[model samples]
Target chain A: MGKGILVVLSGPSGAGKGTICKAFLERNKSVRLSISCTTRAPREGEVDGVNYFFTEKEEFEKMIKEDKFLEYANVYGNFYGTPKSYVEETLNSGYDIILEIDTQGALNIKESFSDGVFIFVMPPSLDELKSRIIGRGTETEETLNKRFSSAADEIKLAEKYNYAVLNDTVENAVSKIESIITAEKCKINRIKDHMDVLQEV
Target chain B: MGKGILVVLSGPSGAGKGTICKAFLERNKSVRLSISCTTRAPREGEVDGVNYFFTEKEEFEKMIKEDKFLEYANVYGNFYGTPKSYVEETLNSGYDIILEIDTQGALNIKESFSDGVFIFVMPPSLDELKSRIIGRGTETEETLNKRFSSAADEIKLAEKYNYAVLNDTVENAVSKIESIITAEKCKINRIKDHMDVLQEV
Candidate 1:
């Protein structure tokens, strides 16, 4: 079997990126979603190690100074970062890692790690995207509009992504993601290690 | 849908590239195997367009001089080349093109065209590869060993390929190739065109 692949997923909020990542993990047993460390207060029902590796501001800053995160960003005054240790541990253990990150963070990760597959999820249509944002019921009308406008700007940057998976349906999106992982492993560079062993025989 | 992808496949003679390509095309109606323009006399029962596009040496040379062929080579004193027009026509017609070319031709095509996937097919194991070559019964013992030695050298060049497909089973190999074509269409650079058009509305 070929070594594992690193898949970085990004999309505008309400594009159902979280749901697709959950489905991908359910279908692929060998995949691990890298749990990010955040400086934000954990909401009710969120576990320390399960939902996120909750950290204090000072600790987060320390990690930053140490260059411990692959990429980090501040959201609403709270810092969220991907720890290099967990992702590396998962990959070294023969499991692929999936990082559900934002577009900026995805770009940063891609710059540092050129081999990671950067996928940007897309909504079916702008009207449909607006409807989904409204359906979330977690924001005001103005907030929803702001998100809708942000998606437009972000779509411009999506051209830099390695793949764009449209969330027309959950099932279809998950299928495309699975196919990408499978096809990526078959890439010549990733599987070249096996050939080196084959030559000795 | 985005423009169809062009995949150039190459491998050793007994690596089962033809079998894998045929099975893959059977499952994917969008994929068309590129037929080369050859100066060699057609074998018994080989159709003109199906087996190869037979051409006179003068016409073939004229195409070469006009820089029409993507890549051309002389094999056994007979010239064979992939016509750029046929491939471009097929792609423009919205069909994915698959060329069953050799390593040398595959490299030349890769250098000339930056896009399109380059897949190098290889047997699963050396012993298995030898068995497949021997089963063909077209070569004597001495020639068989020579061909086997050439396969070793060719596998070393697998580094130049975009993907290395192990032809362990026809069904599995075909599925992998089909998956690759499906995955390529989902690439962000390709799918973003449709999204860009949608955003304009």
Candidate 2:
């Protein structure tokens, strides 16, 4: 077996990245989502390792200092990060991993893992994005406007990604991501070992 | 519609490139095979425009002189070439085109069309390749050995391709090619117009 692929999925908040990732995971059993380490407390029904490897703030901070995180950020006085060891081990063990992160985190991860497949999920339009965010009903008009502009700014960064998948529908988006993974596996660089074996034959 | 992709499929003669291309086209109705211009007489059941675009030797030489062919070669006193204009027009019209050619022709096409998706197909094993060639029952023992060595030489060039797919089965090869086409469509560089439209939104 070959070393598995690392797919970094990123986009704006309301671009249906989460939904697409979930649907993709459901369809692709061989791929596993990278479990993030967080300082935030686990909510109801959330398993310790399955949902997140919840840790204390002190440990999370120590991890940051050790450069153990692929990318980390302090959100609402709580820490969230992707543990580099976990992802590396999974990939080395021949298990594809998907990291669904925001634009900033994805870019940060790129610096350390340039080989990862960076995919940017996109909303169909700004109006569609606004409607989706508004559907959450958890933001005031002021906050909504701020998030809208931030999302627009994020969309501009999609150019930095290797592929931009428009989230017109969860099914379509998931299918496209699946295709990306399939194509990546077929890439010449990725199948060097296979080629070598064939050469020997 | 977005511009169509030019997929250049190449491999050794016994690597099942032709079978995979035919299977892929059967499933993918939108993609058309690029018709080659040849000076050879059309065999029984060969259509002028479908199987090949038969032309006079002088006409083919004129096209070669005008640099109208993407790639051309003379074999056994017969000339064959890919028409550059037809490929460009098909892509401009947003219909994907597949070019099934040998390794030399594919590399030649690459010089002029670097944006094309170049895929190198491989048999499961060289022994399998030998058996496949033998199955054809056309070559003598001396010619078989020569062809086998030539195939080995060609396999070495697979590294130059963007993707290398093992033709373990026709279905698997066709599916992988389809995935490649789907993934190529999602490439960031190819979707510049889509990005521009989304930016305005």
Candidate 3:
């Protein structure tokens, strides 16, 4: 409670979760986005530590064995994980951190750190979400159906989150997230100053 | 969960809780202020519904017997209580309600409606609080010490509250309270609509 909050942001692929997270970071410069560790090689134009902390497959597996990752997932033949040390150290330094992950990753983090704030970004409706995915203009009918069904599955897990933000407008969603951060700081458990100040008086 | 929140605002008399609650109400019109019912007769200028809901002693006792109050206490020679029906009705219609009560009354409400969000407001220091009370120029030295000690006692119980606002400045305190209200609304348990919407889709 003395340290900064660890916020987990999750949603469907086209729910604008990333946009809201970006807007939050822009508005609150002290808040940082967590850089994930991945076993995959860096793609073209991607920078190490900027895009991700690319690690060898053996190193990733070793970290996983050591429980260094808060949550990890195996996609295709590559592993991607959120390093626990990075998150803990950043929060200890009094900088709030936001982690953008899929629904499965979010649930994994919940098991590891139940105290972290969990937020589920949602579209106004499934129809709106379908239209948003269509607006991307790059999906085949098969992939689009897969994505639509995946989104349907993810939305059902929204109940597990502590908060839900309807991503209807970027500005409105960002404002609400900002307020949530401010309010979390005022929680009785979070204000260690109150405990210390009263002790001296 | 479809209903609005019932927020309990409580603190010592000189802690500026009233000012913060008033500021919150002015900013959020949909959030109503809860009016208590009292067996004692209203003062000359006090109006029913606007002030306290005046009640006959027998009727008040009857309501108490019938479990019609969220909480009730016999103060001095009269009984004052929060009418359960009024609070439930307001929340049922989708309007959030804030109840400004003393520390004792706040504890009483906690017993009956534990879901209500409780917030405690505090002064920067007991010395500052004493000065503010003295600035009123209406209290004798003896009364001043009583209020000061009372506030100190009340602050010790602040950890029981869901949130605490240090009233360093009226504007800052009001801003924090507003954020708290907004955050509470986003709570997963409060927004059951998210679950319902996903099911329909």
Top TM-score hit: 2
What digit string (tens of lDDT, one per residue) describes model 3 on residues B1-201? 478889999887778887788788888887899998898777666789976889989999999999998898886467889988889999988888999888888998888788899988878877777778887676668867777767777788888899988898989988988899889888877786634556665
What stretches of model 3 exceed 4 Å from their correct place?
Answer: A40-48, A56-58, A137-145, A192-197, B38-67, B76-78, B137-145, B194-196
Return the top candidate by lDDT: 2
A36-74: candidate 3 lDDT, tens digit per residue: 898887766778997689999999889989999989998
lDDT score at residue B14, model 2, on the 0-100 scale: 84
Tens digits of lDDT, candidate 2, A1-201: 889899999998888887898889999988989988989878667788887899999988998899998899875467889998989999999999998888888998898899899999988888888889998776679867878878878888888999999898899999999999999999998997856535574
Is model 1 an incorrect, acceptable, medium or high docking prediction? medium
* Residues forming the 10-long window of minimal summed lDDT in candidate 3 chain B: B192-201
Candidate 2 residue pairs in clash (backbone atoms < 3 Å)? none
Residues B1-201 of candidate 1: C-alpha lDDT, one tens digit per residue: 457678998987788997887788788775788998999888666799986899999999999999999899986478989989888888877788999987878888898877889998978877787889898886778878778788778778888888888887899888788777767888876676666424653
**Chain A TM-score, cand. 1:** 0.90
For candidate 1, the clash count comes to: 0
Docking tier of model 3: it is medium
Give Cα distance to truth, residue A22, candidate 2, Å: 1.1
